[model samples]
Target: MISRLPGLSLPERVWNTARRWAVAWWRILYLGAVVLVLVLSPSSYGKGTRRALARHLYLDTAPVLLGFTVLAALISLVLTRIVVVTALSYGLSRYALEMVIRVLVLELIPLTAALFVAMRCTIPNGAQLSRLRQAGRFDALRSQGSDPVRIELLPRVIAGVFACVTLAALSCVVALVLAYLGVYGFNMAGLSGYTRMFGQVFSPSVTMVFVLKTLFFSLAVALIPMAAGLYDSGERAQPDSELGGLARMFAVLLLIETASLMGNYY
Candidate 1:
């Protein structure tokens, strides 16, 4: 049941689609910038605001942190064991630690943490925001001389970002520990070699990319769904409305990961 405009050529239609996507991305970036600025402004944090931010941060981060770390530790243990055993069998054990650090800690953990936060916090919050928007809650707040973005949206943004970053960082630590233990068993003798290897693997540029990539993932997870919700026209405020935003967030995550890989290896 889909149809195109009667007079538009294929190239024109394609250009129009691209233009729409570009505008959507611009809006997301602009809104994210506004939120970032608000976060930095001292006035945004009164006693109630701070309390609310803290509550939201706890709700978003604490419950998930332990579970995520446990899961990540288990996965890292398995991967590390496999890599170590395979490398030992092939007489290439020296490369196993580097591979684990690169693959698990540097790449997989961050990406998985971002997705986990998106699913656990941001996407649902975005859907709620969309529902509020559809129900005219934001409009009502504005009419009463309240800035809904600051009072309502900002806390969620902070919570989402914190959750993503905290989960990634904690999971990364777990992965690194599991890797070391898997490779060297429960012994302190390998500590010096392990430190040297870790140092070599995380050179300045690679470390910068890893940090930046995790930050970018956090920001995207916090912002994209909110942008989609804030700008939603009420017509599509069904259960599936958040799906498009989720897809967009995933795409952005993949793009960030790909760029990080290029920076690290290429």
Candidate 2:
């Protein structure tokens, strides 16, 4: 029962691909609405649900993020030393602190945190959720009058967003401190000039954009994988959907980084 119309087959394939992307985007939008509701509804932060999620997010993820924090600190310290030495070598030592704050704090930490949550938590958890669906646990939950998206998936999504925001903020603070130490050592002699430079770099407009960028990064980290899981419209679970989700997420992340660069530099 196969009809091989070659010319029509080509057009059909093209339309199919287009339709697939369309469906994927629609699913993403729907998930965005769900997340918005969760954000606006105070019930989301109720005692039992948020406690379990936050406890899991904080306690369980703390060890991983602690290790990650040390790693990021080391990397930031190395990069700070390099930027400082290079600036001093070029007689641009005065600009080094500004560079450190802009590059490491505003740019690197947020993107790195998003990627860490994506790779470590989101994708793997999504794949596992897919497996659960494939194993008929989805129906099992439904049989108990439990909606998986609201009860189960939302927590993971919220947790991922929380993880991204938490890690990014914490890492940026650590990097800022390390940058100061790298450029000025333990003494506070250079503190006044450093504070002036920080003020110049983090003006109100720049701060607003930074907050917006971080918010977008958090949404992207949280939404993509879970939405990908929702949109796995195949007969069984597969990696193809997860891989496509990652590609899409990173594309958005890159765009965010590029926009931040333009905002900061241009």
Candidate 3:
């Protein structure tokens, strides 16, 4: 009788699974690095590339920004009211404004904006990319002396970044204004106090952490889906791939938020 190969032990199986995960993650990072290099290259900003980028940016940003702004404003208003009322009840009114800024502006808005972009734009774009890959469009473009990534994918990634940053910024501004109104009730007398309070809340270190966290959130929203699509082999349908991308993106966002919270509070 022919000899049979032995089955893997539990440790060997676990090791194999971990190694596969590591290799997959390394490939994703490699793809991100390549995109970053192309983005920074002077030649990547050709006339055609600029036009494509502009189109993608506009499409990704304009339609969703207005809706998200309205929603964010409503949520901010309600949350601000709740916080202000609770602070008054607890005789902690003095700390209400700082709490609002830290919780809503620094934490919630950026995270929400990233998730909004991922749901509205990047996930769908990734699915489309996977479909194109399934149809071998990438290889066809390569055979035509064209770079599919630069021409087709980079713009979506850049636009996703723009959408996340812009949405978060606009929402934060709205939240700050609403917070002031909720706390001080549209009195011009509170303007100086509001400005001072804002400055106090956003110390240099806190500001740095906020900015870095927002940028990382934007990148996670944009890049994870793109990476998933780039590596998807079409063994699964588009919806399944999108679901996996969403899970991965959520995990990364959670990690980023956890780190930001530690940096800010600890």
Candidate 4:
């Protein structure tokens, strides 16, 4: 009597366990997404899908890029003025441009842009996916002969990837210009060293890999949260689920970034 009160049967337990694993599998798929991007890099250069991806990326990233540019410009202006004042105080104004480019454009801006999009876009997308799942929309779509994986999920995935890459590129460019002005005061004397450093940091292979990494990061950021969103089945689809989705998304994003950094440096 005690044992039969309402305990889950073996199959029920197995099903529950499988469901947990399915949720975990998305984390794995996030890694797989990165690998897929790397493998598909050659084809993405000029293919129709890649072109569509680029268009979506540009469209989605336009507002964000503009905002980043404004913020970066303001910060650069303040920092440049500060550096110039300090240099005048010490007769060392010549090094300001190099410092700005190296510290801000080459390193900080790209990373900051990626993080901003991750927080602003990817998190909400995940929440929407969760809400859709809770409303049985995904199932309803499936019933109506729609492939959720292809139609609903893939576009966002593509868009996310595109946003990250384009924003990174745009931010990097802005940072470079700001750095040059801050340091060299519109002169070309430092162009050779700047180009040399640019080449060193962005060798062909490195650029290719960086693009691939951003693509993967975007895909994972889009997919994992959405996948986590699907975990709210039946009556469990409450506001709390949104928090869970965000937590899962953050964890997955960190995991992907860590893996990417390790792959690159190690």
lDDT of each prediction vs. the true structure? 0.86, 0.79, 0.85, 0.62
Q: Kindly list the per-residue Cα lDDT of model 3 for residues 118-157, writing each as its tens digit.
A: 9999888887887888799999989998898888789889
RMSD of each: 2.8, 3.6, 4.5, 7.1
For each candidate in turn, the TM-score is 0.91, 0.89, 0.91, 0.66
Q: How far is candidate 3 from the true structure (C-alpha RMSD, Å)?
A: 4.5
Model 1 over residues 1-266: C-alpha lDDT tens digits?
A: 11254587988767755665666678788998899899999989988688979998999999999999999999999999988889999999999999999999999999999999998998888878878878989999899987888877899999999999999998998898888888888999899999999999999999999999999999999999898888843232222246567777889988998999899889
Write the number of the candidate with greater lDDT, choosing between 1 and 2: 1
Backbone clash tally for model 3?
Answer: 0
Badly placed stretches (over 4 Å) of model 2 are 1-8, 43-48, 234-240
Candidate 4 residues 1-266, lDDT tens each? 01121477877667765565555665547645753664366644445445645665665677677887788777777776777678778977666555565456544555566677767666666667667766888899799976554444555566766677667777677767776676666889878877776666666765665666566566656566656654543333222345554555566656756665565457
Q: Compared with the true structure, what per-residue lDDT tens digits does model 2 show for residues 11-95? A: 6757656666667777888989987887688776766567657765874267567977997899889999888889989999888
Quote the positional error of residue 225 for candidate 3 in Å: 0.1
Better-scoring candidate (TM-score), 2 or 3: 3
Q: How high a TM-score does candidate 3 get? A: 0.91
Ranked candidates, highest lDDT first: 1, 3, 2, 4
